[model samples]
Target: GESFDPRSSLYLYGNGDGPTSTATIDFAAATGTEYADEVENVSFRINDIDWGSGNHTDVVTVNAFDA
Candidate 1:
């Protein structure tokens, strides 16, 4: 269910936490030109463990550097 975004950094992702705040993710410091040089698939931990044993696939993109 991955789609494309022209201005990804302008958008914010929430509720990345898994099951009662087991996991939390944050996106910052984007350096992309119209979604090209973006940071994809930022990593996080689930209750200090693996994210749902690879069952979860939550990712974010960084695209703050634009004209």
Candidate 2:
């Protein structure tokens, strides 16, 4: 398992007028260190979703690599 700074967070806000939205999070910037070369697993914690109405649905997609 790995640990990250509790204060580290990435937020992306979309205007709700587009079919898709995108953002990038630099792990080195967020953790103050580069990701290890052998890393095989990564995880994310998502919160504070603003489902304005009861009929709204959201999909989250994440892509990670050793760039």
Candidate 3:
């Protein structure tokens, strides 16, 4: 079992006023404990502020490697 809190390590940048925004997460910089033999599941929760009225879309990607 393993767990990490990405709040301190995650960085978000890019033009919010524009059509797109980008968020980058640095797992290496994260301040937490992690231990896992195999990744059985992954989850993400995104929060937005002052999102105006319009159709919006979200895309998420995760990269994993065997150690």
Which of the numbered candidates is closest to the native, going by highest TM-score? 2
Give the top-scoring candidate (lDDT). Answer: 2
* Ten contiguous residues with the weakest lDDT in model 1: 42-51
Error of 2 at 22 (Å): 0.8
TM-score of 2: 0.43
Per-residue lDDT over 1-67 for candidate 3, one digit per residue giving the tens place of the 0 to 100 score:
3455856345444444454665554334234647544444556644554444554444445565754
Model 1, 2-60: lDDT tens digits are 45454543323345444433233344456753554346655422222234545354544
TM-scores of the candidates are: 0.20, 0.43, 0.29
Candidates in order have lDDT scores of 0.41, 0.62, 0.49
The runs of at least 3 residues in candidate 2 whose Cα sits more than 4 Å from the true structure, single-residue gaps closed, are 1-4, 25-36, 54-57, 63-67
Q: TM-score ranking from best to worst?
A: 2, 3, 1
Model 1's C-alpha root-mean-square deviation from the true structure amounts to: 13.1
Model 2 per-residue lDDT tens digits across residues 2-67:
667789777676555544557776544435556553444567777766555653556677776665
The Cα error of candidate 1 at residue 17, in Å, is 18
| Candidate 3 residue 21 C-alpha distance from true site, Å | 2.7
